[model samples]
Target: MSEGPLDDLDRRIVHSLQQNARKTSASEIAEQAGVSASTVRNRIQNLEAAGILTGYRPEVNYEAASYQLQTLIVCTAPVPEREVLAKKALEVPGVVAVREIMTGTENVHVEAIGSDGDDLSRIGRDLDEIGLEVVDEDLIRNEYECAFHGFDVKDV
Candidate 1:
């Protein structure tokens, strides 16, 4: 694992994995980067060891999975306690993800999936019980993601 900063090859590997980690193979990425398969594999291991490459998670379609409602709950917690509260929020049923923002008001954002309004209400109450003040919420209709272009090879 040679380290100073990520070189061009490293960036190209990351970009390719970000595009589709589940489907893309080391040989394919190596071919695109003009490197060997083992090189690509070692780079991926080093990236993970350095905490640059995190876990690979599937993109789930909650609505299609019979969880009809996807809600984004915006809440506020004391800045000092925000991180702790965010972790606690995850323990609540239906809560899928939580983000702690830097601002004072509406500093915590929680993503939750439920079957209906009742499920959302239950989650909201649970959050409140854990000391988060629910400020606002909205139904999440869609989401999208793309690989970072800064890591892309110009001619790939």
Candidate 2:
């Protein structure tokens, strides 16, 4: 519910990083966050150490690539079973990420990519073979994507 103990400068630095981590230089972040380059570097190190900033990776567009079909599979399983099922889901062809949602009709949300209908069907069968039942499935139409960095910094 709260971003614990993050001062104004910390929030700004984080926001700048969230916008563009790779291309944005320390001086640029310092200018935006209203700090010096040295300050930006120091704060970033501290943020990494504190685990607020873990890692950065580029977002991949599955449709633009060869993986034409993207899907979200909602699955229900006990918490204990959920983790194992999540890990196993990764082994299934075209499955990208499996998230364990704490609250939902299903506890596991599998983000998957497929080339066609057969690939999608194989995923369902793969899950069934692993004893993970998919309660629902939705094909992603389009994505209007942005990086929020997992926080709201408007009033920071």
Candidate 3:
């Protein structure tokens, strides 16, 4: 198959894997998504090779690992500079992921994990040095939910 936009079956395969890639089998997703098991497997391999389906990762509880402080930092800055700023945010002590977002006020969002309150404070300062206006700093108390690539199969 060509490395083009995902068709309905391809999107269904990706969506099923997104739901539960570790526990779910290609055959199982095929049954649920209404495709053949071999089709599911082949499509998944193709998506992975195309870089659409990246590697799988376990979602770990950072708090249990002594990373007690979590925070969301949103910044407003030039679109061209957002990527560089995001990269710099990664060098900050506890930053985990830097996401470029589109919002009325902000262009860059950062997720930071810290050992404690003091660690969080330092992370905030380190992020501040990146020079974008900190539009908001939200202290994450508990993660209600987390998801990877969630897409509607119907949208495929």
Candidate 4:
């Protein structure tokens, strides 16, 4: 990791990975970024070491996987206990993700997947027991993502 900000090469590598990490190869990214494959590999390693490249995750289709219900459980926790409660929520069965928002009310947003309504109800009860007030629950239909445009390389 360099002490300075990411250079053009670093930005290009990150942008390429963000678009598709599973299908893209180091050689392919190297060609697009006008660098050698080894350089691309080295850069990726450095990025990971610096914590700039944290993780690569697969996009899952819960419905296709037989998890018929995808839910967003919005909750409110005491401001001082928000972070702790958010972490505890993740331990509950069916809980897939938990986000702690920096707000007074509705500060914890939890994403959960369940086979049916009963499963969701159980998860909600578990969250409540952990001190989170279940404010709302909505069915999640879809999600979309894109690479950050700031990482796009400018034509020189």
Indicate which candidate wins on lDDT: 1
Candidate 2, run of 10 with poorest lDDT: 145-154
lDDT of 1 by residue, 1-156 (tens): 324578888888899889999999999999988889999999999999999998999999999999999999999999999999999999999999999999669999999999999999999999999999999999999999999987887553
Better candidate by TM-score, 1 or 2: 1
Alpha-carbon deviation at 78 in model 1, angstroms: 0.2
TM-score-better candidate, 2 vs 3: 2
Most TM-score-accurate candidate: 1
- Candidate 3 C-alpha error for residue 140, in Å: 1.7
Task: Provide the clashing-pair count of each candidate structure.
Answer: 0, 0, 0, 0
Candidate 4 all-Cα RMSD: 2.3
lDDT of each: 0.93, 0.83, 0.77, 0.92
Where does model 4 exceed 4 Å of error? 1-4, 154-156
Decoy 2 TM-score against native? 0.84
What would the per-residue lDDT of candidate 3 be over residues 117-146, giving only the tens digit for each residue?
788778777777886677888888876543
Tell me how far the alpha carbon of residue 151 in candidate 3 is from the true structure, in angstroms, after superposition: 4.9
How high is the lDDT of residue 103 in model 1? 69
Error of 2 at 32 (Å): 2.0
Each candidate structure's TM-score, on Cα atoms with residue i matched to residue i, is: 0.94, 0.84, 0.78, 0.93
Which residue segments of model 3 deviate by more than 4 Å?
Answer: 1-4, 33-36, 144-156
